[model samples]
Target: MTTERREPDRNADERTMLEGWLDYHRCTLARKCEGLTDEQVRTASVEPSVLSLMGLVRHMAEVERAWFRRVLVDDDAGWIYCSEADPDGEFRLTDADTWQEAQATWQAEIDIARRNAAGFALGDLSRGRSGSGGEPFSLRWIYTHMIEEYARHNGHADLIRERLDGATGD
Candidate 1:
């Protein structure tokens, strides 16, 4: 697993600090999936949920792509890892039948998200992007929302992975 050092930018403001925190949490979530076997990765302690470590990786990948690449960047791009046929199908097990496949998908999505995030300025919150809402939302709100979503899920992942194996943090 790779860890990036956090550096404070003299020019950065509060939003940049918050974004850095968000990025750290996201990276941590991805790291949780590292150094595990295929069977261990797919093992689910909770029945009916199928919320395996690999599943979380796939789900979070979809999230990064959906939020950063699709919603925040381009609205016209087709949804990644999402479909109307099965709304929550990204979590469903499919041909990611192997551990390698799951890891590849997760890494690919994370790479794309990091690349997209690198392009945006911390203060670039002027555009109002509206979802299934009555009004639009600022970029600040979107960044915060993504951070919250990842942090919440990472907590769940921590427990799930611990249950699956004795593995813990990076």
Candidate 2:
């Protein structure tokens, strides 16, 4: 079980502060799934929704790969989990999907993302394509979007955990 040890500085520069807070949220998400069984991680929040700890982890891996490898690094390996054939595959957890593998994959993506974004400044533009042919973005935007993505999913994790075993936290 992973424990929470993320502590962000109250004061820092833009990059430092954003990275600290983003790491805090990342650790927070990992903490939300601590000590859970494979089946437990796959348990959906409600009957109608596809929300689960495993699904969230998988989705984050997809996000990390897309933003870092495809968008940031200009690679073509897009959508790690979902696809046009199975767009919701990340949330489609089965007994074959182990938590150990999920954690490792997510961690690997996180590492790649960190490395890919390391060379760029906050104001650097993205080289990825867009609807209008191509539109650039700041590294700051990527960092902030990552924070928001984790924050949203972490909230879902909180609800799912609470529903699973009455566990709760900030």
Q: Each candidate's lDDT (Cα)?
A: 0.70, 0.84
The backbone clash count of each candidate, in order, is 0, 0
Q: Which stretches of candidate 2 lie over 4 Å from their true place?
A: 131-133
lDDT of 2 at 164: 87
Residues 1-170, candidate 2: write the lDDT tens digits.
56655667767888888888888888888998898888889898898988899999999999888877777767787676788999989998876888899999999998988888888888887766432556766788889999999899899999999998899887
lDDT of candidate model 1 versus the reference: 0.70
Q: Which residue pairs in candidate 2 have backbone atoms (N, alpha carbon, C) closer than 3 angstroms, thus clashing?
A: none
In candidate 1, which residue pairs get closer than 3 Å at backbone N, Cα or C atoms, i.e. clash? none
**How many angstroms is residue 105 displaced in model 1 relative to the true structure, after the best TM-score fit?**
3.2
What lDDT is reached at residue 66 by model 2?
Answer: 82
